[model samples]
Target: MTLSELIAQFRTLAFDKVEPYLFDDDSVIGWLNEAVKEACIRGQLLHECDDVDICQIAIKAGQVKYPTHPQLYEITHASLELTSINGGKRTPVCLVSFEEMDKADRDWRDDQDKHRLDPYFLIQHDTYVRLSRPTDEIGVLHLEVYRLPHKMSNDDDVPEIHLAHHEHLIDWALHKAFGVPDSEVFDLNKSEMAEQRFTNYFGFRPDSDLRRITRHDVPHTVKPFWV
Candidate 1:
């Protein structure tokens, strides 16, 4: 549904269909943005692989880290791309938790091997990617990731997510509408119910589902270097 359509749905479902609506267009759109973001983050709806700015990261020699996509919700897979006669050569880079690295080798941080290429990436603070070691050469990491929603503007705007999930957006907006504090539309019971429906369809927001998706990427205790 378009922004206007979704707003109308929110009004109808929220029982503010008459004149002087309890929820304004701008307000409902704000709730929509939040809802879509939650849907994308939790359901991994807006997965991207070919978007250059989002799926590609340039690397400079000696740099061990790089800023990830601004709207990156989570990284699913990462591969290193190096200059090659065939244009570019891509190699899989393992993803691991710091604790796993610590368990395998306490001296993991001491490697500081300037001669080594980035072999792994650690998700740091949800904004920057920490490399296993400093880069020996310039390259890029091709990534597959789920991204936050694009902000919708006026009524003409549309959501980036697929049309299949459009009607579902209304549930979240209704949840927000019913939860409006100090507002005429506020209803705690309805708010909870709406939220429950949204969650039931989209599932809860993921904390770190990437780990489960890439469990094999974790280094083994006996063969830590193989990763």
Candidate 2:
């Protein structure tokens, strides 16, 4: 839903549509943005909510530096392919860790010929990829990265989450909005209910399965404690 729609819905749910809105537009928008971030973090592990982008890194001969996206939160995979010298076919290059890359640099300094073929990389400063050996031939590096959710500023901007999960955002926004002291709508029960609903619907814990057991599932002797 649009930000305007979300605000309207939140107002309706909070009963704040008298004359002067208990929560202003900026406050609601801020709450909604917070809600989006919360939902994004909560659902980050779910593949259904992930967005895939194919980024191309241009390789220049004797250049080992390449910049990464500012919004990049995590890199799932990185693949490097070298273009054949004679325009034949692209060959895949092996990816190595920081330690391996450092070792490769040391080995190359000692004996360049032996380690020239081994191209390794490590993320530098969490912002750029540093390759161990300078590229002998031009190639492209493909990176599959997961980025943080985009914050909504305009009314028409849509959230990155699935439409089915949008209501959770509203619940979170309402929870936050009602918690504000100036709003004059301080209901701990409502706030807690919204939070619990969001967690029950989207939050997944390691012990969720064990926690799902009902009282009826317990033995007669253990029922009293569970109840």
Best by lDDT: 1
TM-score of 2: 0.64
lDDT (Cα) of model 1: 0.78
Location of the lowest summed lDDT over 10 successive residues in candidate 2: 209-218
The superposed Cα distance between candidate 2 and the true structure at residue 221, in angstroms, equals: 39
Question: Which residues of candidate 2, in runs, are more than 4 Å off?
Answer: 45-54, 63-65, 84-115, 119-125, 181-193, 204-227
lDDT (Cα, tens digit) per residue for candidate 1, span 66-99: 8987987677788887663125678777677676
Tell me the tens digit of each residue's lDDT in model 2 across 40-99: 655563232133332567777777778776665445556666654325243434444454
CA displacement after TM-score superposition, residue 40 of candidate 1 (Å): 0.6
Runs of candidate 1 with Cα error greater than 4 angstroms are: 84-88, 116-125, 208-227
